[model samples]
Target: MAQYRWSYTSLQGKRYIVGLFHGPKTGHLMIYVNSKIVQIDFKVFEEKVYSFFLEEDLCEITIKKDNGSYGYDFQINKEVDTPLNRKRKAFNKVNRNRIITMFVGLGVFLAVIITFGISQKRKKEREKERYLQEMLAKKTVSATATIDSVKWSGDQASFYFKFYEGDIQRARIELIDKAAVDLYTQGLPVLKGDEFMMTYYTYNDSTSLKLNEPTNLQLANFMYRAFEQEQKSQSHLSEEELRCRVKCAFRVSGISGLADVYFQAETRESNPWHNRLTYNKLVRDIPFQEAFNEYCLPQ
Candidate 1:
C-alpha cells in the first residue's frame, strides 16, 4: 500500500472542507477526520484521486478498507502556510460596484430583518391579546353554560372533553418528559412494505393541533401505558425488554421509499401483534445520530 500527504490553507477566515479517498479494488476506503467517518463513494475509485481544500489547521485523516469496519490506517497533518500574494490578488479583484452592491445588499437584508422583527413582535402581541380575549369569553361562557365535561378513557390514555356550547371551540393537551428516544430498526423484504410509527404526538405548531385526527387512539393508550410502565417497572430493565416493550406498543401505520430494507418499532398499539414485530434483519443507520455520538457525546 502507498500513502500520501496533502496540504490546504485558506485566507477566507474559516470554513469546513471535506473530501473522499478511493483506491484499487481491495474493498473501499473510509475517510475519517478527527475520528469521524466521512463518505467517499467506493465506485468512484476508477478515477484514482479524491482530495479537497480546507482551512489552514491541523486535521486527522484515516483510511480504512470498506465493507469491513476494523481494517484501516490513520494519520494527522497540519496545513502549512504559503505566500499571501495570491490571496491578496484575489481579494483586490473586487471593484467599486461590487463593494457598493454588497453594502446595499447588506442594508436590504438588515431592513428586511428589522421589518420581520417588528412584524413578529406585532404578531405575538396580537396573539397574546387574542388569547386574553378568548379567556375572558370562556369565563363568561363557563359562568352561564354547563362546564365542559372531561372524560378520561383509561384504555385510550387520553382525556376527551366535550363542550356543550358553540361546538367546543377550544381544547389543549400536552405531554412533555425527559426520556431518551430508543430506536429499533429491522429490515423488511422489498416485496412487502416498510413501516414506521411513533408513540407520542408530534408537536410543531398551532396548525398541527388536530393531531388526534390521524393518531391511533388504541396505540396512544398502549404507548402511554407502556411509557408509564417503563418508568415505574424496573430501573435496570435489559435492552431486550425495553425493545420488546417498545415494539409491542408501536405498530406500522404505512410505508414508502424503495431502499435496502426498512422497519420501525416503537411503543404504540396501531399494528397487528406479530406482524408489527416482523423483521427482515437488515442494517439500520442514520448519519446525524452517529455524528452526534462521535463528535458531541461524552464518552
Candidate 2:
C-alpha cells in the first residue's frame, strides 16, 4: 500500500513532489502534486495514466500492475524519467552528477590498482617457489596432516593442519588447488578434521603445496537450507510479543575456526522477531526475556 513517489524540478529551479496513489481497498486513483490532490478517480482495474503540466513540461504518471510490486512509470516532456535521472535531479540537484562521475573514474582507477596488485602477488609467489626449488632442489616431505581448519582471503585460501612434528605454532601454507580442497573437506563447505598425506616444501617460516592446483570448489548444501529457514521464518503477524534470540559469528582462535556466540532477548513483532520465548541453555537454563532486548535475529 505504498504510493509511487517522484519529484521534478523546473528550468527555474522550482521543485515539486509528484505522487500517484491507487488504493487497493478504496479502489480510488489519485494524483498528488506538492502533497495536494490534483485529480481523483474511481476504478476497479489497476492500470491508469494521469497526465499534467509542470511549468511548460508535460508530465505523465503511469501505474501498471506487474507480477512483482506494481510498476510506476514517470515521464516528463515526452521522455521517460528513469530512477537515476529522478535521483540526480530530485535529491542531489547540483553535486550528485559530479559525485557520480567521480565515482566512475575512481572505479576505473581502482580496477587498475587491483590488476597491478594481483600481478605483484603472483610474481612474489613465483619468486618464493623458485627460491624453494633452488635451495631444496625439488625435495619434498610426505606427512599425514589432520585438517584443523580452512580460511579464505579473497581468492587465496589457507589451510591449517595438525601434525606430530614439534613446530606447532600454526604456520600458514597456501597451496590452493581443487584437488587439495576436495581432499580436506568433510563433505561440508568449510572442510576440517580430515586427514591426508600431502607433499610440501618449507622455506624460512612458510610452507607451500608442491605443484598441485586446487579447483572445482563447490559450496556446501547448507546454504539452500539456511535460505529456506530464513524464508519460512519470515511469515507476517499482526501483533507484537516477546522474542529471544541467540547469535554466533565465526572467530579465528589459534588455528580453530570456532564460533563466538552471543545471546539476547527482545519484545518485538512475530514477523521480524520471534514471539516465542528462548532460554540460555548454557547458564542454568534461564529464560532470556524482554530485559535483554539488545538482540540479534539471525537473518
Candidate 3:
C-alpha cells in the first residue's frame, strides 16, 4: 500500500499532533513536525514505523517495529540568531566589569607592596645606625675599668658597697660579690634603702678585681644560718628582736642579668601583706643596730 508522511509547526508554545500514516515496504520511515504514532500493531505480514520532527531545543519522538528495534529522525529549521545575540550582549557586559575590577585590584596590590618595601628599608637603616653607635661606645669604654662608680647618688646594690679596714668615717673599696650578698641577705626581711654596691679595684689600666657571692642559693643559705644563730642566742631581746624573730614568708622577683632583689615579707600579724621592700644592689641584711654601726655612723 502507498503511504504519505506529513509535517507542520505549532503556533502555540506546545506540541500539536500532525498526522498518522501507513508503513513503507523499503528503507527507514520518516515522521515530521510534531507527528507520532500511538500504535502500529505490526504482525508477521506487517511492517509499520513511527517518527517525529523537533525544534532545536525541544523534545522528540521515536518509532519502533514489533521486533523491538527502533529509529529516530528529527525535522529542524536552522538555529535562530536572536537568542545568540541576546547571550552575546550579556557576556560582553560581564566581561567589561570583570576587566575593570581586575585593574583596580592590581593597582591597590602594587601600592601596598611598594609601601611595605619602603618601611622595611627604613627599619633596616635605623637598626644599622643603632649598631654603629653601640660599637663606638664599647670601644671607648674598653680602655677604662669594666665597673665604674660615679657616686653613691641613687639606689644601688648592697654588695657593691665599699668598706675600709680601721677607718670608720670613710672607706676605701669593698667588693662584696653577688654570692656573698645573697648569703648574708637570706631570711632577713627586706628593709627600706636596701641597695646593691659594687667596687672596682683598678689594679692596672685595663683590669679590675671583682668578687661577690655567686648565686641566690648562697644568699639564702646565709640567711638561714643567721636565723639559726639568732634563735640560739640567749640575749634578752627587746621590741626590735620581736620584729626580727617574727615568722615570715617571702615573695621574691628581680630583673634578669642585673642583680636586683625585691622581696615582700608576710608577717604573722594583723595584715598578711604588711611589709614589702626592694633592694637594687643587695649586699646583706643586717640587724638595724649592726647596719647603722657598719654603714651609717658611730655607735
**lDDT (10s digit) by residue, model 1, range 64-150:** 455533232332242334334344445566665688899999999999999999999999999999998776554443311111222
For each candidate in the order shown, give its overall lDDT on alpha carbons.
0.37, 0.51, 0.38
Query: Which has the better lDDT: candidate 1, or candidate 2?
Result: 2
Candidate 3, 25-86: lDDT as tens digits: 44433333344443343332333333323433332333444563333333332233444445
Each candidate: how many clashes? 4, 6, 32
Q: Give stretches of model 2 more than 4 Å off.
A: 79-299
TM-score of each: 0.17, 0.26, 0.25
Alpha-carbon deviation at 199 in model 3, angstroms: 12
The candidate 1 region of ten consecutive residues with least summed lDDT is 178-187
Q: Please write out the lDDT profile of model 2 over residues 1-299, one tens digit for every residue.
A: 55788878986899999887776666677888996888888853677777877876778887778764467788874445755456556667568788888999999999999999999999999999999777776455554555677777665567777554345434444547554543443122444654445554544444544322222221112222222332345335211211122211111110111110111132335212121232123212322332223343323
lDDT computed for candidate 3: 0.38
lDDT at 44 for candidate 2?
32
Residue 25 lDDT, candidate 3, scale 0-100: 45
Off by over 4 Å in 1: 1-97, 100-114, 117-121, 124-139, 144-299
